[model samples]
Target: MESASLDSRFSKPMLDGNRSAGSLEESVSPKPLPVDDSPSAPPKPPNGGFVAWMQVAGSWCLMFNCWGIVNSYGVFQTYYENEMLVYRTSSEIAWIGSIQAFLLLFIGALTGPLYDSGYFRLLLATGTFLMCLGMMMISICTELWQFVLAQGIVVGLGAGCLFIPSVAVLPLYFSSHLAFSIGVAGSGSGVGGIIYSIAFQQLQKSIGFGWASRVMGFISLVTLVFPLLIMRVRSSNPKQKRKVRKLFDSSALRELPFCLFLVWGFFGFAGVYMPLYYVGSYAIETKIMPPALAFYLIPILNAGSVIGRTVPNYAADKTGSLNMFIPTCFGLAVLSFAWIGIHNTPGLIVFIVLYGIFIGAFMTLPFSAVVKLSPHLGVIGVRMGMLCVICSFGILIGTPVGGAVLRQGGWISLQSFGGAALMVSTIFIIATRVAKVGAHPRQKV
Candidate 1:
């Protein structure tokens, strides 16, 4: 999801001993002045420096694997539907991408705690191996189940392991310009999508699917190594796992604004990727463009996202993340409907570009919104993790459901279904904002 919430993403890692969160501010002192938490680390953060920015760089690399690959699965969806998995329905093939996306986020509940327990290096090495191994296995896969197993589960879990730590450590380093830093790192999702889509699109035509997939895997393995070397987070004693709480901690879910935000995410995300997963296939089906040109849509959308992810976040830092986030959700809802009107080549391209910008902002803002909306510092991780997990379920069920709709209702219905879902999601997102800040339009919230 590349959901970049701060200490909710970063709080625990900043302290000297890697002391778990929640009790730190209280255990060390009863003083009302918010001066000290753990004596082991400095009272203030090293907000800007070479090392701090490198963490951003490493996270950018991680986003390439975590979401870049997931977003580009549209190319695979088209290829599988046309060539490899003709026996399968679009709904059936979508499970591969859906489950891949699901596990990448679903396991956040577990990975978040384990990372806090000082398992960073172990998770990184193991995740990188699994990602490369899964891609290699994809090269040889002949069956639908094989693709699902290799790409869906193995690679999904590997990304999940790497993802939590990628966003988690950022808070320990920065404070004032946190959202901008995360936006830069988060943009890697778009960067990865563009490169990987182009790689597979060009290579598979020349070398065939097996080697094309393996080449992507090779890139994943090599590029991933930089993050392993450059990213450095000191760990706590494995035994003293203080402050680590579970992702779906029950107490956090009971909050109204948080729960409402979860609703917005679930339905909004359900419709969000419908276009991304199906646009290429739609172009081919409608004959608006040949397969040659249709292939570029994925890369083009991702290319637009390169700006969408960073620019909106930079703006959000001033306007407030959710302040910008709510309108972006509305833009996505509008674009999903506008996609229905795009019949000609230019219109389709415009649709893709606008969708890219809106969705990129949509994908980037949630973690920041969650961080600000949290009731207190102690449970930010709990709240943010819950938001991510619930949203993962939405991503899991969304596109396959769209495929089923596509099967029954045709493209108009498919577009309508996606649009309607986003509208509902937009309503809920507005409700969440209103609930948080009482419909005060002038207020920055």
Candidate 2:
């Protein structure tokens, strides 16, 4: 009878690491002085001592150096066009960054699951080494394929590893304030973008491309220390080793929320990169705007994005993720169709701020929504990887499409393309709502 009861209790999926009692008496009655079930206790919340916060801060620093620099690649787009890769079309140059972004999301599919099973140290070390090596190697590239392999493949993979581990490990440290912590940590991208933008611009002129990239590579090494020190995974069931296999789980794609998320990602990328790719060029083409000012706005947009990313994440935790996400999508659609279409100085600035905020919210809220919709925390990496696969399709298509529209109809046509894409995002946001309703008729906001 005791064995049967124990088996029944252990069979419950939610009780995977928990103990079960045979009866009320077994649960609460006083036992012999030597009786002990301490080994079966659930994992405790991390103490989040100074060391914990330090770890979080360190993760942010690494993210800033890697993912943050990835976000700021727009600054280099114009420079590469004028100097090194003059033969490449604007669309082709855009592909380099697009692939970089695509890989950042695409590689997550495998890394997420690997991380869940307890390869945190291995993953972080691999990402750090690859990223530093890729940056250093990129300094010598003078052709398209070299850039593609070094920047597109290697750096993309490194950023992908960095992204999943940083996000996944944080939950183990802070459960209640996860959103806030993520927001604070995510701000690293913005800070990194600003620093690199300034450094790359100044150093490209003073130190040359090789040394500028080498300097950034050195900074990446300094930022990797936090992940080395603070990341930890507390296993609830030590006897159960995390089984490793091919990490991509296609089954997650069938779920309605993830499908809607893919649609959202496609349109989201289609709209977000329009400004990133075109803003400086647009400013230069107008001839009235100075080159320095045009270069200055990219980082400014990213600075606003830092705030946009953090604040909406905090708000989404209070409000519903869907509620925050949908409105931001609609707002971006409006900013694209309306403000960017105007083509004047004031109109362009307004579009930049509006789009930055919406994109910031878009990035933060979607991950939160994915987590909320997932059936189990253990599979978050897999689910996130699946989401990235979908998102990569968007990144792959978005900028080149925008560039094509610009070629065919000029700035006006590009704005129209952005608007249309954002409208598609709004449609998907509505689809998400419908999917939620179908899943739970009486579900509250």
Candidate 3:
């Protein structure tokens, strides 16, 4: 009885000490600390553990399978025009890609919030099923509306599901190594573009359109398995409650940095994909290249882009995203207006190679900039979703506008339109910089 009483007496204080330790750990940890103090805490060590990096690589492969084929839609454009949708106008055909790009960005408005609320597994699985289904369906499509439903809507929705979740989840896994992780993931699009471009080109000749798309569908199925297996959320903090108490926060939109970035998002997307839609067509029309050779260039450009995406993102993490982004914007503008506008054979080839490099880098850096601009992990999804909404408008309209320009004056009109769009985009980028300067002028390095 005396020993039992002694044990009971020891257990009380042990419980109390454990409670106190829990409280103290929560107070000291980086996550629960105040926002003002977060920057002061030493940055998280690059804890890109093997499992974490593996997940990033897996996400990369998944993205290549889903969004990469979207990038290679140019090859399909050439094939579909001559074969399947022969009656469709170039402008009409352009909508297939436009709708696909539109869904990818527009759906993010909802998916981003869903992701922030912690439904990642559901989202990834649903996306994989939709993407595979869409690719398989596209093989059987013959009419314009059918293509729209299969390729445009279904594939677009799937891309949306896959793309944003991969991006949103990366920050949860790696804090200091965020850029490196994202850069690696972003390259999947480039690699996908190359692989799909070559595969579709060859399969179109050997097995015909139906089998060609089926091959892509099979490849997508294989690629998607990794993300389902490996990609996981690791943040310790609970998800931000998306209740009526927090439905809308207009105050966030008021921030100058976010507003400026919104404009940058608009301009950035407007010019980025114009080349993708036209490069193959331009190559064939110029008489210096065969249709097959021209289609192969998309992947070649994407190959260069793999380097472009990775290198610039590493630099952005060091030098500020805006610092890396401005020069790339200027490079794209110059390449589009001057080099691409003027070149015939050699100039077009050189322009595509150089432009692909800069544009790929440009695409990767913007997301890092968004994360830096809004450090509140809770709001990252909403902020990025809003940005995507604005950017979607640019993407939706940019290609149609390019198509209109092409119809009016042919190649010269398209070059001028692309060039002018880039210039306008650069203006917004500069304005973003000015806003940044004004917001933190006295703050020193």
Candidate 4:
């Protein structure tokens, strides 16, 4: 009876001391175990392996067909304004491209939720069908609404559907080296722009507009199949039904760093495509380069982008994605400013190459940066979707607004606008970095 009473008295104080220790542990010291490595912890990505790389290859094909064609829109914009849709004002014509840009970012709002809920194949098949169908439809379009409906709305929706999964799914297979892999995959966009731009320029001259677009449709159909066959999600809860109410992650908005980066993307994209859209025309306007040579500027830019996309991403794996991204944004801003003063072919070519390099790096680094900021792989889709949806507004208005300025104030004014937007965007990126890791130069961000 005396031993039992003594045990009971010691147990109560021991429990109290343990409770105090727990509080002190949280307050003053690191836990013995990592929170992320507990039994109910999230599944880890493979980081790198054969299947992971094949996933990258598949994603490459999708990006090639989706963003690739969008990047080539400058070629189309110039073509329609000069020959096909000559009856329309530049601002009116700008709306078609704007709508296309808007959908590319905007449709992620729906697709992101679907992807996270395990609807990968359904989204992929549907996207393939719509994108191919839209391209074929573009061939037959001779009217403005037809272009807007087919190219802007149909193609944009298809591309957006294809894009979200490719970007979101791949990151699930990689925790480290994500920037490099994504950069390599994204290089397809540059390659696709080069192929489509050259094909459109040559084919339209040889076979006519209708056939050129059909040929592009056929190419997209072929390339997109590879991705559809190989891509999938590595789900931690494959059998669990996704909550309908949880489709969007509202908590992401509370992250000041993520929001700052989103704003950075917003204002950055506002002028990102301006050079691609207007460089060819600018060349023709200055009469410095022959029309034939002027037509090559977009291709030149895209060619340089191929290198820019791959190389910076490799470097970003080490120096930090946002670290590299900030300087590139500044470089792009300077390039936009300088593009306005180039009245000679050599200078134009130099500008195009530099612009391609910086923009390629700009496009390549941001996605990986977003991935770095996410706490869970499952939430990646939602976060990326939201960023795209938010940035879509900037891309939507960018070309139309720039085109309007072009119509009213000439090339100098448009250049200034593009440059200003980029400069402002760089400031936001710096703010994002500050919020993330503070001002320590050695910090990886």
Candidate 5:
């Protein structure tokens, strides 16, 4: 086409052995537009620098408050069942945490488009306020309905608002280090989990549940201040200049690989929170660990996750997110079975740590995989929000189902169920990779 266009503009087909008079005349009459061979390129991400890393730091703070508190639900699960909500069965108590996790992911689906529309600060501030308020509300609650409203509904909504921006912001700042940066920011969940769980554990003993909850709220209020101040969109010009996306766009669902990835996330996460919610209770009930020491299992698990989120994410930058994610899911499946057999403190601790690491890898890498599945950068937030919709349901049912399984058929059935969910997840992730990149193992997806 380029050759034909140039020929038509610069010259006409000539009679045999004769130069076209128009060719020579046409060349001097008007010059044709110059053509460059290469297509125009999009601007590159900054990849690294002061402002970019500052965004990462702010994102880390956001994550600390969002996922961090969610991860600490186990501490509350233990405390409530033993003291406050003892009248309720384990299955019933599990609903509070599951609902909390559910609403965080479900409501997040609506706010992703809002984030793209330059409502980031508004989302963050509203979320942080609700988070602090929910914690304070939790401090005052004695009834089941109050706990659900305060911790499950209010805190969950706050978390949902913050979730997308904390994650999606990194793509604007770093490309090569995207997984690693996300991993680093994501480690805040682990660190946050460890601190909050321990804080609640110690404080509840000395100050009672009400003051303990208030102290945690104060901590959330303080930590969130940093993110609120430093975080900004990558562009000085508002993203509101772009068309705002719809709240319920599921266009990515039309793609086969994405659908398969959603299945992978759904079943995989269905089992992920089971141990986190029940490990403390399981340890004490079975006499595998001392009662006083059992609550530490959550912190131990999160500490492992801090490492899991980091090293595997660094490796994912090299090996590909789907590749790293498949094996991690497999490890979690294996560890779920391993969790069923522990009879001693050392064994329980080992299971907790490994579970934490694998689940941490599972949590962070899936987002990267979702981003890779995205057709373009512009739709990543929406795609991520969609992914969260699938994952949130998994989280919603995971713990309560485990509690029901525990009540009905004992730990064996509960552990087996969790393992099977993850096994299916691993298989589908492998399928997602094959669908995306075909049978070539060496090629990056």
Candidate 6:
């Protein structure tokens, strides 16, 4: 179904000496065991060990502080409307989040290339500083423009720097279990969502808006330290000089599966951000749930995601990432469609929980799938950056588009647009699978 040359080109180059005995796939055995390598060469991943597990934990905390806070934007969306920026139109306020989401992914264009050049500590340290600083700045901001600068652009840029490296490092640690490791780290987003949303809600009531944000900033500062100490580049070629380049990976763009997957991410994000940014407002506007319960909807959805992110990825290792991805994409589309018809409280609850689970799985698998198609593990950071850059445009516009549609045609129009984007994305997802492993059901792609 796909080009034969692409398969041959995908294999890794063998190192000199004993490493020349096997292919890269052979080097990555099914079990999580350490590989033997030359002392002068780069480090081989242990796959599973106290040191390796600690790396994953550090990455988890980074993801929690970065994307986790972004995932919880729905809580902010609701609060902006009801209290803080009450005078602003929904579309105006929505821009803050759209810009935040956009920059978080867009800046990967630069950070990804930097990460590939062995600047792990610099990226992680700089990102943590900017993110914490942004949060503290948000505490004192009272204007829309100030929020835009502090929360949207600064925080978003920090997140991109931290998120790309945190994810890229996992492939270096676990080849056989890459998907499961990514899922575990990615699950931090769900945990952060639950914790931050709850904290934002309770703290707003007790200490007011400014101090609530400052408290969260303080917590992020504390959590960020673990990653700084434990996470590091494998440093296999200790003496290799780093090369600087523009963020784009021109070579990766020529590959068919890679091209197809980027198309899928572009449309997929158009739908993905809709629920994460609007579910809180939807519950309140529909009046199916009370204000108190509606506020907790994001947390409830995130709670389900914690389970969804971890369990499906374990299955994905056995069944293949693309195999699991198709169903998750379908589920996201169906849920978007279903949201329009939901009227009762119980139905809303059920829908949110299912939405959380499916979307979590939907977002987690693509990283593993993309890495599998990559021609060189060394450039995985650049390839991932390119994908995120393409995906960034869709995220940039997703919330604002939804807000505009909601204003003009109400929830039905908004949900219909989201559902349509997701359904269209599935075609690309399937096409990518066909390109990778053809139509065979039994193949592990």
Best by lDDT: 1
Q: Rate the local accuracy (lDDT) of all candidates.
A: 0.81, 0.70, 0.71, 0.78, 0.79, 0.79
Assess candidate 5 and give its lDDT: 0.79
TM-score of 3: 0.85
Off by over 4 Å in 6: 1-40, 243-246, 376-379
> How well is each residue in 181-220 modelled by candidate 4, as lDDT tens digits?
7888899999998998999899999999999999999999
Q: Which digits, one per residue and each the tens of the lDDT, describe model 3 over residues 222-313?
A: 99988899887654324333221122445567778678778877777876777888877777777768786777778777887888889888
Q: What is the C-alpha RMSD of each candidate to the true structure, in Å?
A: 5.1, 6.9, 9.3, 9.2, 11.1, 4.0
lDDT of 6 by residue, 1-445 (tens): 2324332232221222233223334432221212235455444556689877888898899888887898888898899988889898787898998898889888867776577566889998898899999989999999999999999998998888898777877766665566788889989989998999999988988999999999989988899988998887675565755455445656676778788899999999987778777877888877877677888988988888988899999897777778888889988998999988888889988998999999889768777676566654434555667888888898888778888988898889999999999998998999988887689888776
Ranking by lDDT: 1, 5, 6, 4, 3, 2
| Model 1, span 1-445: residue lDDT tens | 1123433333444343223222233322122212224443333446678988999999999999888989899999999999999999999999999999998888765687777666777888888998889888999998899999999999898888888878877877766566777889999999999999999999999999999999999999988999999997744333444556656656556667778898998998799999889999999999999998999999999988888889988887667777788889899889998888889999999999988988889988887787667644445667777777888999999999999999999999999999999999989988888887779886565
Model 6, residue 375: C-alpha shift (Å): 3.7
Assess the local accuracy of residue 153 in candidate 3 as a C-alpha lDDT between 0 and 100. 90
Give the lDDT of residue 66 in candidate 5. Answer: 87
TM-score top scorer: 1
- Where is the poorest 10-residue window by lDDT in model 5? 11-20
Relative to the unseen true structure, what is the C-alpha lDDT of residue 112 in candidate 1, on a scale of 0 to 100?
78
Weakest ten-residue segment in model 6 by summed lDDT = 8-17
Q: What TM-score goes with each of the models?
A: 0.91, 0.85, 0.85, 0.88, 0.88, 0.90
Give the per-residue Cα lDDT of candidate 5 at 90: 88
Error of 2 at 291 (Å): 1.8
Q: Positional deviation of 260 in candidate 2, in angstroms?
A: 2.3
- Candidate 4 — which residues are off by over 4 angstroms? 1-44, 242-248, 372-379
